[model samples]
Target: MQHTVIDGVDVYWAQGPAPMIATLTFGCGVRDESFRTLGVTHLIEHLAMSTLPRLHHEHNAMVDIEVTKFFATGKPAQLVDFIAAVCEALSDLPLSRIEKEAGVLTAEGSSGCHPTAGVLLARRYGIAGPGLAPWDGPGYDRIPAEAVTAHAARFFTRGNAVLTLTGPPPEGLRLPLPEGPRVVHDPVSPLSVDGPRWLAEDVPCVGMSLRGPSVSPVDAMGLQVLSHRLTEVARKEKGLSYGVDGDRASADSASTDRFVWVDAREGQEAEVASILWDTARELATFGPTAEELEHEVAGFREMIEDPRFVDGDLDEFARSVLLGEPYLSPAQWLEALAAVTPEQVAAALTESLRTALIVVPDGVRLELSDVDGKLVELGGCAAPEWQPQGKVFKPSLLARATSAAARGARLYLAPDGVALVDGGTRHFVRFADVVGVLARNGSRTVFGRSGCVVPVDSDLFKGIEPAIAAIDAQVDAGLVFPPSVFAGD
Candidate 1:
C-alpha cells in the first residue's frame, strides 16, 4: 500500500478495480462512551452525515465497536468534496440539529455489532467498553449536547484518523479536521467469570463466544474451520440451522474474542445448540485434518488475492495504524496462514474453550461440557452470595397485601449505597461506583460500575423515601438524568 500525510492525517492507497473508493476512519467508537453517553458515537455519525447535501454518488458512514468510518465511491473530485464536507461538518457540527438527528437515529434503530455478538460481549465485559454493545444507554435523544461536543473533540480529530483509497490520492483531497493529538484508550478487559458456562438469553440464534488470540491467523483458521464444520453438520446433515456466522473482536492489545453464531429452524433451537457445542468439543479433542486445513488455506488465499479485497486489506492496516497495534500486510498474513498446521489449530481451540460461553435462545436448555470433559449446566447473571447489611426496608403494605412477589422482596439501604434483594438474588449498587442513574416517575433506577441495577421505587418498598434521599445525596449529580421528552426509556 502507498502512504502519505495529507492535511495532518495519514493517507493510504493502492491501485485497484473500478471507481475510486475513499474511506476515512477515526479511532473512536461505542467502546469510548460511558453508559450515560451510550449511542453518542453513532449520534455523532448521524450529525455529520445529516449536514451533507444530496448527491448521486454512493456514500455512507458507520460506527463500529472500535472506529467510525465514512466512505464514498465516485470520481476523484467528487470524493474530495464528499470527504471535505464530512470533515467540516464534524469540526463544527450543527448543534441545533442534535434533537432532530437524535429522533432520526431512534427511527434508524441501529447497533454497533450483530445482536448475538452484542449479547456475548455484554456477557463477557459487563456494561463498560465493548460490554456496552447490547445497551441503548440513556437513549440517543437523552444524550446531552455537552457530552456530544466533548466526545467529538476528544475522538474526531485529524491526528486520530486514517484515510484509505482504492487508488492514489486525488488531487485537492484534503482532510479539514480539528487539530488534536491521538487519543490513547486503555485496552478493554473481561469481567471476572467464574468458569465456562452455557446460558439462555432472549436472542434469535444460538451463539458461542470464547476468549482467544486477536491477531493470530492460526486462531482465525481454527474459527473458520469451526464455521465450516458447523455448516456441514447443522445445515446439511440435520437441516437444523440455516446459517452460521461469527466475528472476531479485539478484547485487548494481546487477546481477542472469536464468536460463532447459528440460527436454528423453528422448534429446533435446542438441537442446533447441541450440535454447535458438540462440534466445538469434537474439534477441540481431535483438531482439524490435513484436508480441512488445506481447504481453509485455499479459501483464505482466494479472498486475499482478489483486487477488490484491497478495501478490506486497507481496513486491517488502518485499524492497526489508528490503534497503535501491530499490522500485517496481505502477503505476510497469507504466509502465516499457509504455515499453520493442524496441531497448532487444535491447541488454539483447546485454550480458547477454557473461557468459552454459549448463549442460546429463550426456552432452549443446554447440556454442555467444558474443556475439562465434565458436564455443565446453564448460568445467568450471578449476584453476591451474602446480602449486604444496612437499614432494612420491607415491601410496602399495599404491595404486600396485593402481590406475592412484593411480599418476598426487600431493600437494604446503607450509608454508602443500597441493595435490592429479590428472593435469592441480590443487586447492589454502590454510590461510590455508580455509573448512571435514571430518574423518572419519582423513582431512581441506579446503575453501578459492576453491572448491578438497584431500583429505589417508592411503590415497591415501604419507607423507601429515605433510601431515595440517601441516593440523591450520595451519587454525583452529574451521573443522574431524567428520561428524554422524545421517548420514555
Candidate 2:
C-alpha cells in the first residue's frame, strides 16, 4: 500500500484485478457531530450519490456513528472524475443547504423521532458539519458554519485518506507515496462528557454513557456482546425499541466507554427511563447467564471471523493506513480469536453496569425528574418530513463489493462482465470485478467477517483492475474511513 498527499488530502492507495470493489469511509468520530445532525453527513453522502450525475450509476453512500461511506463501481475509466467531484462536494457542501434539505434541528434527538424511512433521517444523524463532535444535537446548532468549514479543512488532512482497490489493475496505475506531513491526529478526544445528564428534547428519551475501567480489546468485544444481549432482553416489552443496543469503544489505548440509550412514546418516557435504569442495575445483581456468557465468546469469535464483515480494507492496505494496528498476518487473527473467553465478557458487563448516568428527554421544557421512572405530561411534537434514496440493488452485488466476500463469478453475460451469484449476502458489488480467471472452476470461498460466499465463476477477472483503481481513488481522496479504525486504538 502507498500513501500520498494530494490537494491537502491524505491519499492512500493499493491495487489488484476485475470484479473490482472500492469503499471510501469518512471518520468524523461518533460524538464528534451532534445528535440533531445525526444523519447530516449521511444526507450529504446520499445526496452526492443520487443528486450528482457525473459519477453515473453504481455510486452509493451512507453514514455511521463514527464514519460516513461512499462506494462506486462500473467502468474504471470514470474513477478519477468521480473522485474529484466527491472531494469538491466534501469541501463545499453548504450547511444551510443541508438544513433546508433536512428539517430544523429543533432539539437534541428530535431527529431521532423521525421514522427510519426518509430523506430527513439521512440528513439528521451522524457526523458532519463543525465544532468538536458531541453526543447530542446541541453541538450541531451551536457550531458556526465557519467553524464547521474550518473543521473540515483541518480534519480532511492528507494523512486521513486511504484508498483501497480490489480486482484487476489498470494500466499505468500510480500508487502515490506520502508526499507531505502525516495527517495530524485530533488532539481533543471524541468522547462525550462522563456521567448522567438530563437531556430535554422534543421527545422523551433516556440514556446513559458509562465509563468502563477496562480497555482491553478482548474486554471491548465482551462489552459489545453484553450490550447486545442486555438490549435483546430489555426490549421484550413492545413499548420500547426492540433492538436498542449499547455501543462499547476504547477511545484511547487504555480507557473504555459504553453508551446505552432508550426512548419511549410521548407519555411513557419516564417509565422507559426507569426500565433502562433497572436493566442496567440488574447486571451487577443477577449477572449474565452461563450460556449467554458462552454465546458471547462464540458470537465475538464468529463476528471476528465473519467473511462478509467489511470493517473496511479491500486491497488489505486499509488496515494499515486507517487503523494503524500492527497488520497481523491472517494466522494471527485466528490465534487472537481463539484466546477470548466468556468470563471476560461477564466481567466487562459487570464493570460497565455497576454505575449508571441516566438521561430522560421529556417533551417538557428542561424538566428534571427523580430517579424513579414516572410520567410528567408534556406537549406533543410534530412529525418530521421523510425522504428515501438509492437504487434497489440485487443481493449478488455484495459478492463483488468485498474482497473477503467473493464466492464466484460466472460468464453468463459474456466478455464485458459476468453475473456474480451472491446468494444470502448483503454486499453491493458486481461479480465481474471480484472473481479471478484461476478460480473459474466454480468453487466457493467466503470473504469478510461473515461467512458470505458466492458459488459461481465468470471470466470477470479480466476487467477488474480499472474498477479497483476507480474506487481506490475515492477512498484515497479522504471521503471515508471505517469504524474499526476507531473501534479500539
Candidate 3:
C-alpha cells in the first residue's frame, strides 16, 4: 500500500483484483457532537447517503463514536462513481427529507439494545461529548436542519477526510470535498468515580470495563491474553458462563479503554462476578503461565500474519490518525507482540484494575472488593431539596421488616418530586428529571436524568401503587420511556 496527499486529503492506495474496495472516512462522529446535538452526525450520515443513485455494488455507511465512514466494493468504475456521488452529496446535503430520516433514526435507536460499553461511558462521563448517546434519546426533533448543514460543512472537508482504495485508481476519479481547515475535537472528560463501582442492571450477565493507556501495544495484548484465560476458566472449567470476550476502544490520544465481559445463565450472576474478579486478581498478581503465554503469542502472531489483515481498513487508519497514534505495519506489530513478557502483562493488569468498573445483574451483589480496601458507590449530583406536600408512603415503616438494611427507609411523595430518606442519606428526584416511574411486582423504581436508579426495596416496601401513580402524573406525556431503556439492555 502507498500513502499520499491528494488535494489536501490523505489517500491510501493498494493494488488488488478487478472488484476493489474503497472507503471514504471523516474524523467526526458521536464524540464530536454536544449532548444537546447528540444525533446530528448520524442524521447527516443518513441524509448524505440517501441521495446516492442505485448501483450494482455493495455500498454502506457507518457512524461510530469517533469516526464516520462510507464504503463500496465493486468494479473500479462503479466504486469511482459511488465515491464521487457520496462526496457531492456531503458537499451539499439535502435537508428536504430530514424529518423523515430523523424518524427512521429514532425508530432504529428505540429498537436496538444499548451496548455495555455505551452504558459504562455514560455512567463515568455525563451526557456530554462521547457520553451523550447512552443517557439521552436521539436529538432528532431538537436539532434543526440548519445545524446539520453547518456540522457537515465543518467536519466533511478535505483536510479532515481520507480516501483509501484497494485497487488501481479509477478513471475520472474526483472527490467533491471543499477546502477547509481540519477540525480538532476536544477530548472526553470522564467523571472521577471510585474504583470497582457497580451499576445494577436487569440483564442476566455481568459486564466489566477496565481502562488502560491508548498507545501501548503490549498492554493491549496483555488484556487480550487475560480475557482468554478468564473465559477458559469461567466457561470451560466451571460451566458457569456461556461465553466471554474482550474488546478495546480508543478513549483519547493518550489513553485506550478495554472491556472484559461475561454472560451467564440466570441465578449465576453472583458466581460469575466472583470468578471474574478472582481471575483478574490472579492474573495481575502472578502473571500468565508459560503455556498460556506461548499459546497467546502464537495466536497473536498468526492474526498479524494473516493475509486478510493487509493494510487496515479506512476506518481503522482514520481513528489512529485522528487520535494522534501511529499505525503499525503487520511486521512491526508481530515484533511488538513477540517482545511482550508475562511480567509486563501482569503489571498492565495491575494498573488497569486501579479504576475498573464492575456492572452486575439486578438483585445479585458480588462479594468482590477492589484492590483498595473500600468500594465507592457511583451516583450523580444530589438533587436540590424541596418540601414534601402530598401523601407520605412509609411502606418499609409499615411492614416492620428487619432483614434488609434499607427496610427503615422512608418514601415521601410530593406534587413536584419524590424523596427517599435512608438513615441519614436523603435522595430527592425532582419532577423535571423524572423521566418515568417504573412499577413492577408491587415495587417502584425512579429513573433520574443523571442516570441514577432509585429502587424502593420490594422486600420491605408494600403498597407502592399510590406512590407510582403520584409520580407518574408529574412526568410529561411523551417522556415516559420503557423500563428496558434504564435496564442497560
Report model 3's TM-score to 2 decimal places.
0.78
lDDT of 3 by residue, 242-323 (tens): 7887665555666656777888877888788888888888888988777777786688777656554443534466667655
Clashing pairs in 3: 214-256
> What pairs collide in candidate 1?
none
lDDT of 2 at 158: 40
lDDT per residue for candidate 2 within 394-413, as digits (tens), equals 22454556544444433122
Q: What is the TM-score of each candidate against the true structure?
A: 0.97, 0.50, 0.78
Consecutive 10-residue window with the lowest summed lDDT within model 1: 377-386
lDDT of 2 at 3: 55
Ranking by TM-score: 1, 3, 2
For model 1, the stretches where C-alpha displacement exceeds 4 angstroms are 371-386, 486-489
Cα error of candidate 3 at position 130, Å:
2.5
Q: Relative to the true structure, how large is the alpha-carbon lDDT of every model?
A: 0.85, 0.41, 0.70
Q: By the lDDT metric, which is better: model 2 or model 3? A: 3
